[model samples]
Target: MDYGPWSLVVDAGLIGGLLLVGTLIRRWVGPAQRLMLPASVIAGFLGLLLGPRALGILPFADQLGTYASVLIAVVFACLGLGEDPHARTFGRSTAAFSAYSFAMYALQVGVGMVLAYALFVPVFGTPDGFGLLLFAGWAGGFGSAAAIGSVLGDAGWAGASSLAFTSATVGMLAGIVGGIAIANWGARRGHTDRLGRFEELPATLRTGLVPPGDREPTGIATTSASSIEPLGLQVCLVAVITVAGYGASEGIGLLFPSFSAPVFVLAFLAGLLVKGLARRTPAWQYCDQRTLKSISGVSTDVLIVCGIASITPSLVADYWVPLTLLFVTALALNLAMFRWIAPALMHGAWFEKSLFTWGWATGAVATSVALLRMVDPDLDSHTLEEFGLAYLPVAPLETASVAVTPLIVLTGLGWTIAVGWTAAGLVALVLPFVLGWTRTRRRPPDDRVEAAP
Candidate 1:
């Protein structure tokens, strides 16, 4: 009924409880240990089962679905503050990784269109964009889901957010479980030179706790607390960027009612603009990357919880078959690309790099990095170096896909996602080989990291 800011408080309280319980489960449970399940994932599922719509236990508000959009805007707003918008890294390894990464972004979502038309739309009378949940969730994670959900939700599909959330949760589960199994398989088959065993994985990974001596400051006090709190300064900056972006988006919509831009896209652009201008001012000294990241991380966690808990059991049951088929398709695509094709695309540290890609392809960058740490405890493969630099080129592609995906569905251009991204991926792959930037075939494993040329 009629609610106010207190509803926000109540929702926050319930989610907080769930997060605590989820954390306890991860700390004590065996399966979460094996799967490396994040607390947000567990909490969201718990909320789904116990929420008012399901068991009438946790009385959630109607505004829960909307939280994902808002939180993702915050996440996007903070990203530009810390990012180097300039195109910097483009070595051969970077090109190959970029191609592989682009393929994940493209085909994962592209194939969804094929499935929607060929199977989901016909058999289930589902909308053409129904299968887009695979890409929105699998390739982009919760933040992408929030962006996609906000778009589709505004377009009159009420259940879009829940379906997308479900897809994201499933993708995360599959990515972690499969990544672990794949890492072990590669180690056994002589694909990995690092020889990192699962048992040898750091305790912090499983428990999300660093030993006392290992703990580090989350962010620096760039500004004196007497002037302004460091974390508060970061939050204020994020909020300003978010508001500016959303205001511009609204202005654009009012000027051209036929056109609309995703708030996340605009917020990201706004953050970049704010960052650029700030670079020429004294305020640049106050903006800390770590502080910005902390804000982004908090937004992501809350967004995941809200997004996951927003799932309607009725909606899930209604589309169980198609959702299942869609998830299976995503898993199969990742398996083929990360396993069979990865070696052919890289000269060194193929497994580590590919596994890292697999993590982000199915989930997010955090998942990928964690998977990388598990396999390369010492970071000897230098896969992060390759990815950190290699990702610069394809970063725009990733952003564009997030911005355009809902439009692809809303505008009846589903075939473009299917046909266009596939062609682009093929071109990206072959062009590297054609330019002699990367080899066209897999090199024999030799336990040596190649210098990117």
Candidate 2:
């Protein structure tokens, strides 16, 4: 048999092997455990170093980039499937959190574009729309980076994907390390009520694994494994939805030949439709949220590893100066916003809530949870609870921005539209404070805090 069709199997095996190595490194290396970096991230770097870009030792490296793109779409589809938009009501906290989150996005993109036009365009002759990589990488992480990068690439911005992925790697590291530093600083300033001790964290958490006793069942079996495994069913559901999204996207493309939407966006809509349909019938009982989350988690890990491994060294070398300037400037702005603006916007538990936002703005949601755990070990601050309520409204806007921003850039409205967005975000950021909507009251005793999604 020709090895052509089986090449992806080799890529998957390489990723899996590297992940195992990353796990072992985290387990045995004292510094790695202390840093608490995700194993997938570590594995990605390892793959990059050993792959064709560096040592030319890994045959599957070239194929991993394509895998990252597909996995990102799967991750988005699962996200839509598992999300419950109607579960939470809009309130002051919701408005505040949503506004604050959107503001961060705007500020990051706005500042990034201004700098890119002034420095990158003049110095390196980079594309005017290249500045959006800041938002794509820092706020959007690997998934957004891939989606936006692909869009930008198709729009004639060569090497956008590699540069965006590099930015995401830096942003992820910043979110983890910077968040820990901020949490420690908050503890020192008496902003944190519960300052957790490093020694008190379980070895499993530090090493990124759950002990046997700590491993709770993520989902109940809907059917006997002998008859039909739950995980396999869940995977099948995701595949069906993704295929539906592809067909829909193709149909749309036929009508609007000038515009093309990312598959992830369509996949998310498809997932929402599937989820809504399931809820109206007995099928919902078989669709476990936890199982869906697990699928997303797996997709994310694979995506991150592949995305990092796929970075082209020449691209990084070409854009090193601009990438450095963008990263440093974005990091500074995010830190400033968290330290000053976030406190004024959030009420009651400002430190904890702001810290969570800081983590997420820099990396992904997982970083937010990690930082939140530091300041509110028992999760008593209700930051997650309130954030959940806020996220229902925020997520759509976030997704829309990810989807539309590239299109806007493609249409040559890069800086002009970015400025308008920045203005809108500023309004959202400050309007709440002006209207006296900044204060958060304590939740009632009977208020039930939902688990983090």
Off by over 4 Å in 2: 1-3, 86-94, 251-258, 439-453
Give the lDDT of residue 185 in candidate 2. 82
Q: What TM value does model 1 have?
A: 0.92
Candidate 1 per-residue C-alpha lDDT over 1-453 given as tens digits, one digit per residue, 9 for 90 to 100? 767889999999999999999888878897887688888889888988898768878889988888888898898898878757455747676777777777777777678887887899889998777877888888888888888888888777888888988888888888888888887777777776666665677777777667798788889988778998878888888999999989998999999898777888899899889888989999798788888888888889889989888888899899899998999889989998875567767756778889999999897777887789887888988888778877776777778888876787788888778777777777776776687756544455433334333
Q: Specify the highest-TM-score model's number.
A: 1
lDDT of 2 by residue, 1-453 (tens): 344667878888989999999999988787887777888999999999999888989887355666766787888889889856567566666677777877887787777777766788888898877788888889888888888877777666767778888989999889989988988888777777777875567666677888888888876678789988988888899999888877887898899987677788899889988888889999888988888888888888888888889899988988888888899998998988887676666666778888888888887887888778878888887888888776665566668778887787777777775687678678877888887666544333123222221
Off by over 4 Å in 1: 85-89, 258-260, 438-453
Quote each prediction's TM-score.
Answer: 0.92, 0.90
True lDDT of residue 209, candidate 1: 61
